[model samples]
Target: MGELFQEAILVSILAGMIRIATPILFAAIGELVTQRAGIWNMGVEGTMLMGAFTAYFIATATGSVWLAVLAAMIAGALVGLIIAFMTVTMRVDHFITGLGINLLVAGLTLYWFRMYIKGRAQPTFDGFDNVAIPGLSAIPFIGEILFDQRLLTYMAFAAVPAVWYLLYRTRWGLELRCLGENPKALDIKGLSVSARQYAAVLFGSVMTGLGGGFLMLGFSDRFLADITAGRGWLAIVALIAGNWMPRGVLAAVLVFALLESVATHVQVLGIDVPHQIFLALPYLASILLLMGLRRQSRQPQRLGIPYFR
Candidate 1:
């Protein structure tokens, strides 16, 4: 127990929390944008899985992580296009469309993976490494944990402010927020609701794809089935818990990641508790957090409602 409180161990846990939180932060922020635009996209899980698989396949094939990331973003954007077509153009039920996307992507990725591998040895590729900031990384406890991180981690944190500014300070952002709250108002003002929604969904999809790509390139060496491992769903939970705000979503992701990091260290310390319990700790914490914060969640007024001319 004392080892758990040691400075080194504590620092490791904090660093792990940041590392683990990266993927969720990206997905949650993306989803926040989608939701803010009045779209309830439940296909984030499927989009992430597809992104992960695409990144892994491209990296193994061409040995270019950059290409892999690009391919993954394109794949995600394609999926987002389908969702936009169904909900915005076809007027399909948002929930049904999103769930269908999830199911389709899951089955499709699994089948494609089996066919591609053909029982051969799984291919591996070099992944991103931690880059230490010259002076910042030298700080005793705070430096190593915060400054020395993968490039994707830095990008994820940077996105929080960027997203905030885009949503609150930009004209396009004003239109998007208006679309979510009342598409009719925007429509009356000669704005194109469908066009703005399409753009928002595409942007969100790209970010979600990048999140999945990072998971593959920044964390694991080889591709695994469902590598996203429910992080997409967790991201949605964080989005709701954060009440659809960028900074709030980040806080939610960090809390969940911190819990996960603690669970991981408990196993590392050889605690006598059931491993399953530790595995479930982060998820349980998410549920509890959501319940506590649900009342405060102020979703966009038109969220999940199909906007029509």
Candidate 2:
């Protein structure tokens, strides 16, 4: 236990926490926006998987990380469009629509991957490299943990404040919040509820896609089925645990990531405990945390309720 608190191991754990939390941060913030607009997008897992697969495919085919990222965003936006069409335009049940989308994406990506690889060796591509900020990175402990990180990590953290400002400081945000609380009020003001919902869904989907892309390009080398591995679901839980606020969501993601980092280190330290317990710690913690937090959660009144104007 003393060795676990050593400066080196602590720093490594902090750094790992930040890296592991980046992807979840992206998805959680995006979901925050979606829910703020009264749209409960349950297909985040599918959207993320699609994004991962699309990014992997584009990178392997063209060898351009930038193009791959762009493609993944587009793919995610398209998935959002489908969700919007069903829930917003068609007024289908939000939960059913989202679940269907998840199933569709999961099956489609699996089939597409099999077809693309055709039993050949898995293709690999170069991923994003970490950028150490000049003066900041020179700081003893804080610098390496915060300043020396992948660009995506920086962007993910930066997004927390950006999302807060957007939700609390802007007219669009006001309308979005109102949509979740009372779409009728916004409609009485001559604002188009469906349009705002569509925009929110699209924005969230793009962010989730980018999260998926980063998960692949920044972490893994080769594409595999379900590479997201339930991170999207974890993001949703974080969003809920944080009560759908950007900063709260960030805090939730960080806590989950920290637990995951501790789990990894415990295994490495060869602790005499069941490895499965450590592996399951994050999810178990999340479930317990959510159960404790859900009663206190201040969800939007109209959340999961489709607005029919």
RMSD of 1: 1.4
Q: 1-309, model 1: which lDDT tens digit per residue?
A: 577799999999999999999988888898888889999999899999889999999999999999999999999999999999998889899999989999999999989988988999987899998999999999999998999999889999999999999999999888899888999999999988999999999999999999999999999989888789889998998888788888889988998888788788988899776667755776777678778877776789999999878
lDDT of 2 by residue, 161-235 (tens): 999999999999999999999999989988889999999999999999999999999999898887998899889
Best by lDDT: 2
User: Candidate 2, residue 264: CA error in Å?
Assistant: 1.9
TM-score, prediction 2: 0.96
Angstrom error at residue 233, model 2: 0.4
Runs in model 1 with CA error above 4 Å?
none
Q: In candidate 1, which residue pairs clash?
A: none
Pairs that clash in candidate 2: none
How big is the RMSD of model 2?
1.5
Clashes per candidate, residues 3 or more apart or on different chains: 0, 0
